[model samples]
Target: MSENPHDQPETLEHPEEALHRRAIRSFVMRAGRMTDAQKRGIDHGWPRFGLSLEQGLLDLDQVFGRQAPRTLEIGFGMGHSLLEMAQVAPDQDFIGVEVHRPGVGSLLNGVLNAGIDNLRVFDCDAIEVLNRCIPDGSLDRVLLFFPDPWHKKKHNKRRIVQLGFAEALRQKLKVGGVFHMATDWQPYAEHMLEVMSAAPGYRNLAEGGGFVPRPEERPVTKFERRGERLGHGVWDLKFARSE
Candidate 1:
């Protein structure tokens, strides 16, 4: 007797394929897990402090007591670099976007512990925040350090250096604003160069074919340390929004 189609187990798609689909959905649909408590805390925990898309363009003068150029750091893993930057540059406002719950919580705890008041965070998709919330040409600098490379050949499309996202970032940054990105994955780094090079209204800031060394303001994060121990090469790419 032939095995019934209904009785046969379905061969699931490859995990990488599934992850890529999920990533695309996460970007397009803006659907990600956040518990009610997390939502409430994100909404009301800092009261007059934290920002969200619903609140609209933040009044920087009112929030920080003086208008300052704003810098955005996407996926600030454990906030090590972000916190360090905030401390180093008190005159510039830093907004960090991260999806990891524990990381966000840890950053918030660190902020309270350090009594740092020049930083704010949003625990959601950076694209969503950039598209619906932040005003155009509002950011002075944008940093993306060591984003997941999706190293597999079949999963390269899942990487964040696509044209659409780069264009979106270009629009969000002010004229002459800097867009800095770093990654340890060479292929992803090359992919980033290709995408950003093709992106309109932006120009590469590097003097040579490669990017400059990491800025002194940024501190190495735990992830970077681990990657360094594992002998992964790191690359940094910087682009400026053109007039």
Candidate 2:
């Protein structure tokens, strides 16, 4: 008897390729309403500060106009916090990846308006960008703040902080580089901790165990403040790549 087509042995993906595949994403695409300012931001400011998804590995030094500590942020909503981080740390180069067009435009506009020379924006998905553009061991730190919690039990797997994700992120960070994440949901925090702990080449920065105090480097955003007002607890997890 011939074997059914579905019964054929499946080819396994390389570990690296499997690391980037997401059957379920933590966030839904929401470009939202693009105000005139945001439209203008992409139209005018992009020529100066925006990076195309099609562009491959960047020359970090040339992009920032100097060799500096490089930080990459994923899903920077509205771009306010990213702008703040870039503004406060003038010596560091900041690269933001956000899929939302309105948010991308907002950040680009803010970068132009603030006269910030140390920032760049990627209007694209982070996983693909990281795989294509970011070179291994080139980043100083990676920031992922307030990623969608995907609260339902069945939806939890859609969360981005999986063990494979930790590994992929680790490859991008230099030795001793940091990956800092914050979430207002408790269960997701626990989930994040479990994944990060199992992933090798990283040491938790939260002395001894559990969660850590929110680092000062992550300035509070309007959304966080609003969540606080609603009595939502926040969790911060920081891990550094092993030397």
Candidate 3:
């Protein structure tokens, strides 16, 4: 559940060197073989549902054909939860950003199978997509579920919930639009709370200004179930863009 598809390096630099240079990326593209069905899905589905960086800034209204509440999810692993959210919402549009090919293919295949028109996907670094494609104050909700924890003490710098990221993400959301994040790693959850609490232009929705109970909107995925079985607790946080 700790796999992420954001903050990828621009070049192949040594890890220590990259760290020293302050070019900390949250993910590494691990090699994974795609199934035949996944490949077919990409071949067939992408032409219809894909959004590209080359498209420049997006007019989201034109993309979905109506101005509706939009949710943009970063690092959707295999798109199970994202698909479910789109299917259930119907009126809301969903944009998913991911760097993994296999996951993107799997999501595309699922979308094609489901015949859902409210979802679109980006197969690229999420930060780049936010900067180049997504317009300011355009999104109603932004979700980061089970992002890479980068648990090592030294590697903590690579975590995505830093102040800079929180601020950047805030710019993409409408005032009062929520940034929702979930994690199975307790330390990472605490880290998210710490950074987001200190970041400007936001207000935590949690009752005690801490972690919140998981909302029904976020589906409990197979990975989450497995983690629950192993006695790993999950934490959910929602912070609204208040500025």
The Cα local distance difference test for each model comes to 0.72, 0.83, 0.87
Model 1: runs farther than 4 Å from truth?
1-45
Write out the backbone clash pairs for model 1: none
| Cα lDDT of model 1 by residue, 106-172, tens digit | 5666676667788888877776677666777788999998888877775566566676677767777
Q: 10, model 1: CA deviation in Å? A: 29
Point out where model 3 deviates above 4 Å: 1-22
Q: In candidate 2, residue 141 scores what lDDT?
A: 94
Per-candidate TM vs. native? 0.80, 0.92, 0.91
Ranking of all predicted structures according to TM-score, beginning with the best and ending with the worst: 2, 3, 1
lDDT: worst 10-residue window of model 2 = 2-11
Tell me the spans in candidate 2 whose CA falls farther than 4 Å from its real position: 1-15
Global fold similarity of model 3 (TM-score): 0.91
Could you say which candidate leads in lDDT? 3
lDDT digits (tens) for residues 126-164 of candidate 3: 878887899999999999999999898767877777777
List model 2 lDDT by residue over 28-117, tens digit each.
776378898888889988998888757788888888788899999999999999999999999899999988889988888888788888
